[model samples]
Target: MLIRNPDISMSKANTVPFGIWPRLRRETCLDSGSSLGYASLVRNDCEKQRQIPVQLSKLSEKTTLLALVLGATLICGLPLLLLFKTGLTGNGGLDLGPLMEAVQSRSVRSALWHSVESSFLSALAATALGTLLALLIGLTDIRAKGLLVFLILLPMMIPPHVTAIAWIQALGPGSPVLRWLGLAPELGSTHPLYSREGLVLLLTLQHSPLVFLLVRAALRSFPRELSDAARVSGSGSLLMLRRITLPLLAPSLLAGFALAFVAALGNFGINALIGIPARYTTLPVLVWRRLASFGPDVLPNVAVISVILAVVALAAILLQGVLQRHLRTSLIGLPQDPLAIALGGKRPLVEATLWLFVAFVLLLPTASLLATSLVRTYGLPLSAETLTLENFTEVLWRQSVTLRAFANSTLVAGVAALVIAVISLFLAYFLAHRKPAHRTWASLALTQSEVAFAVPGLVMSIAFILAFIRPLPLLNISLYGTLWIILIAYVSVFLAVGLKPVAAAFLQMDGSLEDAARVAGAGFYRRMTRIFTPLAAPAAASGAILVFLTAYNEVTVSALLWSTGNETIGTTIFNYEDGGYTTLAAAMSVVVVAATILIMLTMNALARRVPAGTIPWKD
Candidate 1:
């Protein structure tokens, strides 16, 4: 506020910043008859005070953001860089000898071939199934579409290893459902899922939901007018779809395929638990086996393989980006409500088939998992006489490893979530509302995270082993087999997950509130705490919860990183199944799946409060 009538003798010069005093001196004009420039002096002083806080606040924020970005870049980028360095030149300076030799090795070549074959086959299957479902659900007036979409996506939410365990129980000789229906295989016969075809099947099942999500989103933006015009011109539905709809959707379908392929290529759980018995070896499984069986003695060889796998995944992503750009179709108008094609006379049949497929996908594994968890032993039938709570009790209460793993995963995931949330809150702010003068470093950090995420978790695990196997430079502390390494890796790998919703929230906010606050002399912290934080908290929490869920159940990243005491929940369950403790694995998986469902349901309850796109399965 300014004083309208100050005495001519008054001076507020000393209150202003340096150089402003000389400027104020030139503005002041003393007069005995009036207050002269007194009003201007006070007004200028008030303006200067307001501007000083803003300048200092921005300086403080910029300095902090730089420090944070530097830390983020190191955490996210350093490991991958070291991984490439070791893989490329560990043998000698600027040498390609080791990488070439490793890639050419018989075992390495076989694994690489297997990886590509399985990924390609599974990706094709996933794309076909997912695209069909997307069209049926998104473009047609299907009953229970929301519930159906959510149910269809549940497999994606379940950890791949868990899915593997459930399917094994569902179709094996001892399968409760099969036995109850008198359809069980011979007791001595080998399990069905322990084969190459089975590997591809599980991979397809695990990844189809990803394709569904992407293709459905694309379908939602499809031009309804084109479909109406085609129909009006007497084009049949199938023909029109083949000629128009599919062509427009080609880019999204390609992206879906690439995503599924990369996901399958780096898949660890299925490749290990299923492929190993099937005599199928993918690169991810090969890397895990090499390191686990041989330890760090074979780290250099492992690094080379990891680099190859990373290159394949990144290459697929880059190719998708290029092809998508080339295939992009520009629409002239805003996207309308999604196409709602009437299924007409065949609606009942189509709906019944969809329900049947959903049942086969969801109920079989879920029921088998519950039956296994309730039984006393792995092969025991789930009759009332055979049922017991011992398996759940053993894993949840009696077993030290399982209990420790639960605690370890909880602590690491919770800490990682909180850390990522805080970083995302500000990092997204800078990115979403960037100033020209803001450092380019924030974007560099963001890029590192995106790259880290795109690279497989198995590959990132190798990077961590290479980066942290040695004691750190300043601290002289080794993080190689420690939970801190997992924490850091999680923060690096899942940062993009945490950044997305907050960034979306930031983009949606009205800047007028902040401008008004700034005029009222609000500092950066005040504006952030009072305005921005409240506005973005729901979204930040959603992102953090997403990060926690992802990192908590993920076995791929922690498979190679887990030591005895620091075993994560995913690794512990995986090890149990690998060690022939099927009942224990099923019990633990049941707990994890239940928790995941509950959390997702909770998020759905709050979805209306957060920005869209945060909850993938939500409408």
Candidate 2:
């Protein structure tokens, strides 16, 4: 209610809104340059006042981010740290004695040798077969190419243990097909699949699809001009393939081989099922057997073997990286049409051979599983008289353990998927839109997740055991023998799978919409909730589905983590098989396969809405 002085301006004399005084003063000071010092003082005070909210916002964001980073570090980083800690250090401090003893042990040496030899052999076979199929289907005018490719990829989607089981049932002494044809091996005879050769064969069949997918992708991007130029120079098909195609495809072939080799090296299911019986243990199987038999006492020794396995896997990854560096091809523009090779008279023969391969690889094994599931007993042939639905009924309804396992796996996988999806969205946002400093940290966190996934599941399980066997500090709680341990392991292992699609989606997204939102004074949360979430939802959903599919049937990580009362689908199937309940295991596997296919089909229906390349099975 005080009167203003006459010298004061009318604008300065009027009462201002609560937040408008700073702006009015700022404008007046700007208009009159003589008041610059006053302007500086006012501006600084206003900035300090403004910074409170901003600082609080930043503090909140940083707190949330810190929590996320610490969680990831606990899940992914701690296990690896524990592995090195156990392997390199002990109560005595910085000791190499355990590692040296493990390396020199006869069992360890034998397992390492078997792992290396079988992995190399299987990789070679898989690469050759996959490359051949890729060349034939991707380059030539093959009939039903899509269907053939899908069928070929099906084997890779099946769990390794399930593949082991199917092959065992298909070629074992009591094989239904072999018995039907009167070519079954004698009852007491050794099963044909219980050998190193059979192990390699099964591994080759399982991993060949990996090579096929890589080579086919490469072929799809192949320059049409090279083949066209070769043909114009009057080169024959074989010559052109040898010179132009193979040379260009060398990197993909090597990459495929490296991937297959790494996969075989870390394969626990095949090694456990087939190699154990064959007395040809691999490192993964050795680790499992040691831990299962001796408990935590053998953890230090097993950590050394895990390090060896990790070294081999890392070497393969490095080799693939080197190969990929040399794969660069100069392109004028988008890739032209693929070179189409007309088979003409040989088309029918080629198609028949492809179908035969499919029948052998996919149809036969699945048929064997179905037949085994329907049988009354393990060795009983599947006839109208012997066939029964009792195994299915037993596992699905009557057996409480199996029912519990089903429930456990579904609940765990679903929760993992949902949680990972939500976490991945925030991670991807940070990766795509954060400040450079924040992005660097985000990328480092992502690398940890990759390391978790890259390490074999068996090795990861060992790491988790070593890390969490004792009670956690401060909390005084032990996660060692709990279902929470398995859930934590799944999150660590599958984080990369969940992040990939979301990151890809973010990379392809337009930035202007976000910028416009920010310019309109929308906060980070608003922009994310209103713009980013909608755009990235499809990708996140796809990634979640992928995680579910992968975790639902996974056995390697849960093999050692499962306790007596808590069982997973993978563990249950394995236990059934281990306990000589083949029909029951087969019934469970059939249900799992059917569930996987149904989920994949549902995803296929939704694929159109999702970004391309999000679904592994889709084009």
Candidate 3:
């Protein structure tokens, strides 16, 4: 019943108390004492008030997105930039002279060639073995498939240094198993596993599970109808494998191969432990040796080597991207149950063979590790008389270095995990819910993290050294030789690990709960705490655990970063092995392996509460 106020002005009415109040007041003259002057003043105030929040919110969003980009750049981007600057420039101008010199050096060339050769051979071996296992377990009617897969993956979960230590003990001349079986090499003869061939074998064993996981996942989504149709068209088992299964698996195989290649190229433990003894230096080993021997005087040279390593890793990443794009298939609906081929009378033999392989790969080395840990000295044969807990007690109780390493690793790894988990949660939230423009920036920031993670740990460590070797600009304090530098490096290298599961969880989330909280007048923090955090906690925790596991016993990043007081478990063990304390190293490695298994088991216990794919060991 309100008359149109053509004279009173529409703008004044629309500004103050929204349209309803204006119309009501104008129609009824509800406030007899309120004049048009007062109304206009109130309207103006209200208009200003209303615009503030909208402006502030827009500002806030822009600020947050900007901060995320800057933070990611600081953490992940700056180091690589610094590395390149150090490697590619000298004096006051751009120069690739040092890099060229490094590339031309005989030692550098040999190390580069060795890295390429070992990585390629190891990746090929891993791909072949992994594909075979994946087909056997994923497509065939294999017994105890879950248990077998878990056991096979145990090697991958074990730290590379630990694996190297165990294998060293297992195959060395003094091996308890080898000696017991009368197959031990003579004490004066060289260990069989201290060569380039040995490096390839260990790299394959450590990384084969990666290929297996990728191929197994692909096998799970495979269209069973193709196999059925092949059989119906008179294809035998072997023919079906050749014509239908293997062809479809090519992309995954290639992807896995690339991943293994990258992993092997970056390997520090096997390269240092086995390669050094056999005079088979790889690029990572060269970087370590240079840094260890010459300190910062050889920084430019090592930076050049780091760049080469990073380039190789980046190439692998690009290849993986290309393969993924090309491999995209147009499949119908949800994937059906995996095809299970029967083995008939060959089932028993196949199962036996698989179990035997598991025993040889997992059980034997682990047993050797345990035996070596109990011995009084490196070459001492294990017996009732020779066996003692002295090695364990010495490392676990007597040695301050070992205790400090454990404490430092736990503290640093724990903090890194927590910090990364929190940062990743916010980042993932922005990525999942932000506007298109903001998301692009956020994605660009995420790529920085990817670069940090993808580059070899040794290279990343060098990057950090280059970036942080100097004192802070204003604070005038150096982080050059502290645990903080290692912590920062851990955060950079493992940020991607923490982000993956959280981001996956967010992408799959309904968003309705968050939307409802917003509609209910909940603030950003309120909604995040009450609605999003609880939902994403499991995935975040899983990521945190992974970060902790990767960082706790990590040698590669800390290898070059650790100072006298700040030793990591990995570096400590490596030091022990380097210093002829093999028995002590074995003891620590045993504890680490035990701790890793315990953590995985804890995650397994909580699998029901976590998201389906959160725990990798679970079904």
Highest lDDT model number: 3
Which run of 10 residues does model 3 get worst, by summed lDDT? 23-32
List the candidate numbers ranked by lDDT, top first: 3, 1, 2
Question: How well is each residue in 1-619 modelled by candidate 2, as lDDT tens digits?
Answer: 3332344456564444657655666475446455333455466666665566556656665665676678789899889988988888879889888888888999989999999999999999999999999999888988788778877887776788998999899888888877887888999999898998999999999899999988998888776877888899999899999988888888889989988998898888888999988999899998887877786568887888898888778887887888778885455545666777999899999999999989988777788889999999887888889989999999999999988898899988999999999989888887886478767777877888988887889999989998898999999999988888999899999999899889888988888887788555466677778899888987888788878888998898899899976799999999899889999999999998898887777767877877766576677
TM-scores for candidates 1 onward, in order: 0.89, 0.88, 0.89
Return the clash pairs for model 1, or none: none
Give the Cα RMSD of candidate 2: 4.4
Q: What C-alpha lDDT does candidate 2 achieve relative to the native structure? A: 0.85
Q: How far is candidate 3 from the true structure (C-alpha RMSD, Å)?
A: 5.9
Considering lDDT, which of the candidate structures 1 and 3 is the better prediction for this target? 3
Stretches > 4 Å off in candidate 2? 1-65, 221-240, 326-332, 335-337, 433-435, 510-513, 608-614
Model 2 residue 505 lDDT score = 88
For residues 1-619, write the lDDT of model 1, one tens digit per residue. 2323334545633234555555554444222234344555456565575567879988878887887778876888888999888888844477788889988799999999999999999999999999999989988887988789878887887889999999999999999999999998999999888888999999999999999988998877776788888999999879988999999999999989998998898889888888988898899988987887786558888888999999999898899999999999887666678877888998999999999998998889989999999998878888989989999999988899988998998899999999999998888777765475453666777888988988889999988888888999999999887889999999999999899778878888887888898777688788888999888887888788778888889999999889989999899999899888888899999999998889788877877876665565675
**Clashes per prediction?**
0, 0, 0
C-alpha root-mean-square deviation, each candidate: 4.7, 4.4, 5.9
Query: Which residue pairs collide in model 3, if any?
Result: none
